[model samples]
Target: MLNSSFDTASPSSMSNMSGRWDFGGEKEPLMHRIHAYPAKFPAFITQKAVAHARERGVEVKRIADVFCGCGTTALEAKRLNTDFWGCDINPVATLIARVKRNDYQKTRLEHYLADILRSYARRHRLHYSPYLKDDRLNYWFDEGTILELSRVKAAIDTVPEGKYHDFFLCAFSNILKPTSKWLTKSIKPQVDPDKKPVDVLPAFEGQVALMIKALNEVSEQPGKPTKKAASIIVTGNILEMDFAEPMVDLIVTSPPYVTSYEYADLHQLSSLWLGYTDDYRKLRTGTMGSLYHDSDFNRDIKNLNATGYGIVFQLYDVDRRKAKATARYFADLLKTVRQCVKLLNPGGMLLFVIGNTEYKGVKIDNADYLLSCLVDEGFCEIESTKRAISSKILTPYRDARGKFTTDTTSRKVYAEEFVVTGRC
Candidate 1:
């Protein structure tokens, strides 16, 4: 029988067991500030959980994040000198994570930046072929801004192969939105016509400096003089990847929310600029909840044993396509959960940082459904805590039609999220 002692209490009732889990606090660790990811969980959450496990005499030798977005868990694991493994469908995310965990010489990066600046300064009016074209290019950037960005790209291309090159490329990627017309405050990619584009060179230089500082801070942490832990980051679909039985000691991840931010569309600026793909929409198909219509899937939704099926069935009469899409999302997530269960060692802990949100006027209790899935997969509930999200990067408001919105007065979507833990 499933353990039933855990309480589903409100955020206000939860104790500050691990102090405050703050992402934007003044004392926030610089390691997680490497890149801005949509709805990324704070590193403090992972650290607190690991500390608790250690106190209970748990041997956390190998850690894995099935949907490791930008490698927050992996980085923390590395700091603690534990082997880490992570995978994601987003190539850009994998690239960022790999670079974040890599130990690069500060002097090498300084020299590379100097070379790029000198090369860039020599080109008084260098004209290079634009990497992107048509509406994709014009929609987010003006001609002048695109030209300046192209120059920076050309300079980045001159860096020698290996981690040094990837480091500069990541820096360039971080500055893409700020130097373009994309809305700065919005998670979804929306062009702000009135937004002024910043100068590419200075912005990129500043980002490089910040990244170097963060890297140095991480390396200077007081600990054993042991060698750095090995980390394996892969670009692959989570549902299809395999981890042999009893491979991982712990799993920490935040899976993508249903009908939330379209990750492929959100990262288009970096995708096109970095030449990861010519069509960003093509990358959308494999992602969860990418199918918006009934024709997109061949499977029958009625076959899945999901607690949220009743809500989806109700949605069918209102919007058949969205209903099928929601069903597909759950089906995909279940497959992923089962895969994760198979990989984890006996008694290993799986901690998911998830939030419940509404879809097409139907309340999708994502956290509850995930808990049910875990129980069905043979995991016992340990403890779950609901905490208020003080500062969130994802847009919390949805329009009347159940679409994400930037409307200031729109209803709040996920002001709180549950950090649920289960033992296999």
Candidate 2:
């Protein structure tokens, strides 16, 4: 399923002096477009790392992505036959990952698709009150559009519990940002006035059909060997997870960018529509990120108000220029990393996919700083890779002024991300 054999890097290519492997190109074979997020790495990057592990005579049974946004890592893992475990603070994202990774019967998926469509057609005309309504709905969509989405979601909820249920729930989540008035200003949702709102029923139907096609294409491929284990994806905070020591093989993830996209606020429509929360703005403050972080943390807005610093330093002292936020965030990150390190088999690898962020012109070399934490905590920096985000095939979102209106920088290039590997 992976095209790694044709593109594997030679030993000479692995040198740090080469700077970073250019994982550039428009032809990302993995499922990057399954759904759109403001910032997500191509699945091929993960493919490269996994291939590197195999080349080292290492047998990888399990792969875990803590910030499994939109399931990029999990999807690639399934394609490569690696036992996959994923976790995310967003419930909707975890739902998407589960639906994509599950080995559902192909015939069953087709049957389920047809059955749900027919069921939806029968119920489409029924009148019903909106699931969760607020002023935002009035500001975002007309009455007809809301009614259409409500009926479709209600019908989807009624699908018999099985593979179909998971698929439809994810489909519903995917449809939220696109069909509503949430503008393509960026990954985050902003109510758009100039653009016409899309009709809900047709949009829902199109998504279902698109999903079936994607599922069919992916399931047709033969898979590689895996750990024969099912990865668990939790929809709650990782801080609350009860994991025993040494519980994972490898840790790979890209946490939320500093002072960049406001994830919860961006997906407020989904949160509101799916019964996660009725108060939309509350998402901005409740999450431990961005300027919205609690005052108790003393987040530095001039530093792009990044949260989660102190929790990280507890694992290792950070040598960054500024240390404004409480050590709570860094401490929590170390706790999670320590849990991941404990989960690994001896000599297991940790591949961290992170970015150095800039907020109000302050550099937050988070990736490098994070690697330092790992190194200080009994991990060895084996190798690292850096790549420009500009080289990848992007969906190309921008405003008339040729600026990224939604991103915090409002510049052509926003932040730089990296893939740093450490061995324990």
Candidate 3:
């Protein structure tokens, strides 16, 4: 129930942000906070989007989130009794998204915990040969910490493959950063020489305790929506997904910021430990705005709309590398919009919770770019609105770690974001 703090944007505001997108559920569910996710929008946005669709006479029987970062929309869809289909390139995201949606049996959770504890105590098979060879793991984790996490992983595997196994694996995956040298509360990946790694068993148990509380809260909490529909979360690049037929009644999602965060780097600990990839850098492939992709900028620049080209053209003079990435991002969004149209039933709605970012004094107006995309794709009834991200520019600056600060020397993050919607 995270608050949107919705209020009507002033009539003269250039963005013309409608106040309707501002109203939503006021508190966040405990289930949604089980894992840390970069750029996950407030869960209530899903509720608000659903309500918006219903108000427009769209009966949302099925919903989809093309870029379902950490499954915020998926869980809310289940609570609202609408079937959900979601996909993310990062497996770490899909794992948490899948786990967050299930209402597991308390007894089974306890049973698995007790078994894992006993197996962990025995401490056999602690030394995994791969640990010695993996440079990335060695850089982050000490030898002792690796052995302890290995035992926890092995014990978690003792649970047969299913939601229960995934649940434990998700727990194990979260503990990797705390038990390693990775800096705390920092979005950037760096080793904190001062960080004394927390003991594995205590951290794992604490996480489990927190998860149990979340489960209890979901089951006993009054006003918690009943689960009436199932959620399907997939791990794959959305750009390559083939939609053979229109399947969803509505699409509600927030697209990733162009080159703002490298999801693969952010989730390296989980991806590596969970065996998602041998080299975490490889996960960058096909990721939106990733500089690593092979993009022919000269040829692809034609796909951009005026808003898109203007932003890229501005950046090209100062930074050629970033300009290429930005152009590719624009092209991808254009294609993504067309693909989204393919997934929607005729007259279905596409609602996006997106924001704009600035780089080197140049504005990257993502909202406007997307609005143009919706138009190019021929989505009718297009609408756009603005919402506040924080106290209006009270702490407009972000420190090196991506935390908000009032200091003018730091990077500026706009206090406002846009909510753009259209009907296909």
Who wins the TM-score comparison? 3
Which segments of candidate 2 are over 4 A away from where they belong? 1-20, 24-26, 124-128, 223-229, 280-288, 298-332, 391-415
Query: Which tens-of-lDDT digit does each residue in 34-121 have in candidate 2?
Result: 5556567677777777766667655787888878878888888877777777888776677777877776676776677677777778
In candidate 3 the C-alpha lDDT for residue 229 amounts to 82
lDDT of 2: 0.62
Badly placed stretches (over 4 Å) of model 3 are 1-14, 17-19, 124-129, 221-227, 391-411
Residue 150 displacement in candidate 3 (angstroms): 0.7
The lDDT of each candidate is: 0.76, 0.62, 0.83
Of the candidates numbered 2 and 3, which has the greater lDDT value?
3
lDDT of 1 by residue, 64-153 (tens): 998888888888888778889899888888878888788888888889999999877876596655554646977888777787888888
Instruction: Tell me which of candidates 1 and 2 scores higher on lDDT.
Output: 1
- Compared with the true structure, model 2 gives a TM-score of 0.80
Q: What's the CA error at residue 314 for candidate 3, in Å?
A: 1.0
Clash pairs (backbone) in predicted model 3: 1-27, 1-28, 1-29, 2-27, 2-28, 17-386
lDDT, residue 25, model 2: 34
